[model samples]
Target chain A: MNFLAIIGRVVLALLAEIGRLSLFIWQSVSHIFRPPFFWRLVAQQMMRIGYFSLPVVALTAFFTGGALALQIYYGGNEFNSESIVATIVALGITRELGPVLGGLMVAGRVSAAIAAELGTMRVTEQIDALTTLSTNPYKYLVVPRVVAAVLTLPLLVFVADIIGIMGGFVVGTTTLDFNAGVYIKNTVDFLKFDDVMSGLIKAGVFGFIIAIMGCFHGFHSKGGAQGVGRATTNAVVSASILILAANYVMTSLLFAN
Target chain B: MSDAKIELRNVHKRFGSKVVLDGINLTVPKGQSLVVIGGSGTGKSVMIKCVLGIIRPDRGEIFVDGKNVLKMDSGQREAVLRKFGMLFQGAALFDSLAVWENVAFGLIQGRRMKRKAAKDIAIEKLAKVGLGPEVGELYPAELSGGMQKRVGLARAIAADPEIIFFDEPTTGLDPITADVINELIVDRVKDLGATTLSITHDMSSVRKIADRVAMIYKGKIIWEGPRDRIDDSGNDYVDQFIHGRAEGPIGMDVLKP
Candidate 1:
């Protein structure tokens, strides 16, 4: 009976959390469509979320691409199909690694920052202060971040796709003894526009998830310094998990045909 | 009856099994400073948040200028909130913004005033709080605790709100700084002739700024009277709290044998 009661409590708590998150998403998205938009804030968030994140995202993609090319060359050599390395590297980077890796990296950097900042604001009563000042915090704080992330992630992923393929190309030509012209030809020939488009679409969704999770956890933080710290941790972990889960779902849907 | 600028009629709030505010009834008259005093976790902050629409009470009504604020829609609520301002316990200034921008946030963002015009008013308000124009350019992180409180006070009165709420305006300050803040509160309230509701456990602040004093115990306002009458209220809880005594009717829930 005690075990059953414990299970019941866990189930109920989980359901309540889901309900709260759904309501937060609804409120934030609805506020995004309302009037009195803060364009200046949105622009500022773009710089913070997108431009500042370029270095980390690029580095992650570049290294992943280089490693992927080497792995493909080694595996294909066993089948006497080592020429397939350039083709597979380009397709893999464009279709999956670019968006997924970029999302995960940004999830770590941007999500943690957003959560810590908003959590501090929540614990300190700045959010309540915004209310008394005739401003909706959703409009003033959450909307700019959500909008920036949704718009900026796809652009970041696009850059990552380019940088990732370049890294692969460099490894293939220099380390794998592949001719530069042939490697470029093989990559461009095998890669489809649909593959790139699908990844960009996934990037946009990943961006939305990252920002929503950060804002949700941060907005609900309680206690004080410890609570803010907990929120920051929760935001990054939840966003990274959601990004991976979302990437899988999107991949199956986009590629099932 | 019509003279009451703010009124809470039997407001009730609870978090899960714990009741934070239980049937709290209070009123603040026009052009007066009514301070609600209570120890930590007594729902003093919750009660003020309820009035500001930051927290929804489980039962009862809150009124500002005879309009039931709890029943107003989002647009109506925003319009109603335009008449009010607040100063939070830790000052709650937006760290992302400069000092002047924090003061002018409502003016520029909520009222849609141009930046140049709003900045002029922000500087004026900062001056009223004894901060120079140069201080306005610095961020909240750059200011001392006392200066942040003054900036918060300046922001509260920036829009010339008809009503103001101060949530523990002197919790972390030194005694001398606290007294300075109390003086500023008194001066600002006098200059604006605004009806003010402040929640604090600081007895000195009550003596310096409160026209009327209310004491909350166990989520209810147990005693209320003019400031001059607080010493002779004849309530045990009031006596214990005002005197900062650990013994008497208000017992600490620390360690039990």
Candidate 2:
């Protein structure tokens, strides 16, 4: 009975946490459509979340694409070498790796930053201060990050897709002794529009998850510096896990025939 | 009081099993300052937070300007919240924003005033708090604790709110600095003719700002009267707390150092 009670408590706590997160998401989303929108703040956050993160995402995509091309070339040497290498690289990057890897990178950088900023605000009573100042903290703080993330992630993923494809093209032509024109043609011919579209859709969802996790953790953080630190770590960890989980679920649904 | 600007009736709030506010009944008359004083963690901040809608009470009715805030919709609650301003303990200035932008946040965002006009008013309010116009260009991180507190005060009063809340306004400062802030608060509050609700353990601040005083112990208000009666409340907890004595009805279970 004692063991069951412990298990029951853990389950209940998990359920409670899910409920809290759902409530936070609902509140943040609802506030997004409300009037007196902060366009400038949204722009500022886009700069911070999407713009500043460009180089890291770009670098990651390039390296991953090149490595993927090399691996496919080595492993599938028995198959139609040139066609298979180019097609798989394009399909893989556009469909799965682009959004997933980009989301994880952003989830690491942006989620931790948002969580740390908001968590510090929370522990220091700044959130309460906003409420008393007649400003909705959701609109002023959460919405900008959420809106920017939702809008920018797709853009980031698109950029990643292009960069990743180029990385593969570069590696195949220079190292694998493939004709550059043929590689590009093969990539274009095999890759469907739906592949990229689905990834971009996933990017949007991943963005939502990242921002929500960070804001939720930050807003609810208690204690002081230690609590803010915990929030930052939780934001990154939860966002990364959620991004992967969400990517899997979205893939199954989006790709279902 | 018929003229009550803010009133709480039998407010109860708890975190898990720990009750932070237990049947708190309080009132602040229009244009008057009511200060709640207690030892640390005695629910003084929680009670005010409950009033501000930052923390909801488990079971209670909160009225602002005779309207039941607990039952109001978000739109309605926001309308009511416009009357309030708050100065938090740690200053809680937005480090991301310049000091001027921090002060102008409410005017530009909440009141929808033009930025140029708001900037002028922000500078004026900063001047009221003994901050120079040059100080407005610097960020919150550039300021000392006392200066940050002043900027927070400026932000709180920027919108000319009719009601104000000060959460530990005199905390984490030297005696002279705390006194300076307390005097500024009194001066600024008097200028606005705003109703004020403040929570602090600082006796000097309590004496300087409060028209009426209430003491909380173990989540309940144990004594309340005009400021003059605080030293002679006839309540043991109140007597012990105000005298800053360790030998008291409160903290009985904790061992003396």
Candidate 3:
């Protein structure tokens, strides 16, 4: 009976958390269309969420591409199909690796920062202060971030795709002794515009997930320093998990037909 | 109901099993300062937050200017919120913004005033709080606690709100700084002729600024009277609290052995 009670309690708590998150998301999104839009704030957030994140996203893409090319070279050795590395690298980077890896990296950087900043503000009553000043916290803080992330993530992922393909090309030619002209020709031949678009669509969704999770966790955080720390951890963890889960769901849907 | 500037009728709120506010009933008339005095975790902050619409009471009616705010839609509630300003315990200034910008946030963001006009008003308010224009350019992190409190005060009064809420305006400051804040608060309230509701554990602030005082105990307002009458309220809880005595009906949570 005690074990059953414990299980019941856990289920109830989980349901409550889900409900709270849904409400927070609904409020944040709905406020996006409401009047008194802060164009300046949105522009500022785009810089923070997109531009500042360039280097980390770039490095991650470049390294992942190099590693992927090496793995393909080793794996295809037995089949004498090592020549396929160029096409595979381009297709894989454009369709999956670029957006997923970029989203994850940015989630770690941007999600943690958003959670820490908002959690600190929450604990200190700055959110409440915004309310008292006749400013909707959602409109003033959350909307700009969510909008920026959604807009910026796709752009970041696109850049990551280009950088990732470049990394794979460098490894294929220099390390694997593949012909640079043949590799480039193979990549351009097999990679379709749809593959790139699919990844970008996924990037857009991942961006929303990252920002919303960060904002939700931080907005509801309580206690103080320990609480803010806990929120930051939760934001990064939740955003990363959601990104992967969402990517899988999106892949299934986009490829279903 | 009788045209009080702020009124809470039987407001009830609970967090899990802990009842933070239980039937909290209070009223503050226009152009008056009503300070609620209570020890930590006695629903003082919760009550004010209820009025500010930061926290929704589980069951009750809240009226600002005799309008049932709890029943209003988001748009209506926001309209009501325009008349309010608040100063938080930690000052709760936007750390990302400069001091003048923090002070001018409501004016520019909430009221949609142009940046140049808002800056002029922000500077004027800062001067009212004894902060020079040079101090306005610095960030909140650069200011001392007292200066931050002063900036917070300036921000609270920047738009000349009809109602103001101050939550622990003097906490975490030296006695002199606290007194200076209290003086500024008094001066600002008079200048605006605003209805002010303040909650603090500081007895000196209560004495200096409160036209009327209410004491909350165990999620209920246990005693209330004019400031001059607090010392002779004839209530033991009030006596214990005002005197800062530990041995009384109010026991600290950890001392329950």
Top candidate on DockQ is: 1
Q: How do these models rank on lDDT, best leading?
A: 1, 3, 2
For each candidate, the DockQ is 0.87, 0.81, 0.85
Ranking of all candidate structures by their TM-score, best first:
1, 3, 2
Quality class of the docking in candidate 1, CAPRI style: high
> Compared with the true structure, what per-residue lDDT tens digits does model 3 show for residues B1-257?
46588888999999889999999889998888999999888888889888888888899998889899999998899899889888988899999999999999998888889999999999999999999999989999999999999999999999889998999999999999899999999998999999999999999999999999999998998899999999999999999999998898888777466
In Å, candidate 3's interface RMSD is 0.9
Report the Cα lDDT for residue B148, model 2. Answer: 95
> What TM-score, to 2 decimals, does candidate 2 have?
0.97
In the range A1-257, model 2's lDDT, one tens digit per residue, is: 99999999999999999999889999999999988798999999999999999998999999999999999999989988898999999999999999999999999999999999999999877787777767899999999999999999999999999999999999999999999999989999999999999999999999998898899999989889999999999999999999999989999999899
Q: Model 3, range A1-257, lDDT digits (tens) per residue?
A: 99999999999999999999989989998899988898988999999999999999999999989999999989877765445898888888988899999999999999999999999999988898888777889999899999999999999999999999999999989998988888888888888999999999999999999899889989989999999999999999999999999999988998899
Docking class of 3: high
For candidate 2, the C-alpha RMSD (Å) to the true structure equals 1.6
Candidate 2: tens digits of C-alpha lDDT, residues B1-257: 68999888999999999999889888889998999998888888788888888888899899998889999998899898888888887888878889999999888778888989999999999999999899999988889999999999999999899998898998999999999999999999999999999999999999999999988888888788999998888888888888889786786567667
Give lDDT tens digits, candidate 1, residues B1-257.
69999999999999999999999999999999999999999999899889988889999999989999999998898888999989988899999899999999999888989999999999999999999999999999999999999999999999999999999999999999999999999998899999999999999999999999999999999999999999999999999999999899887898977
Model 3, runs deviating above 4 Å: A78-82, B1-3, B253-257
TM-score of chain B of each: 0.98, 0.97, 0.97
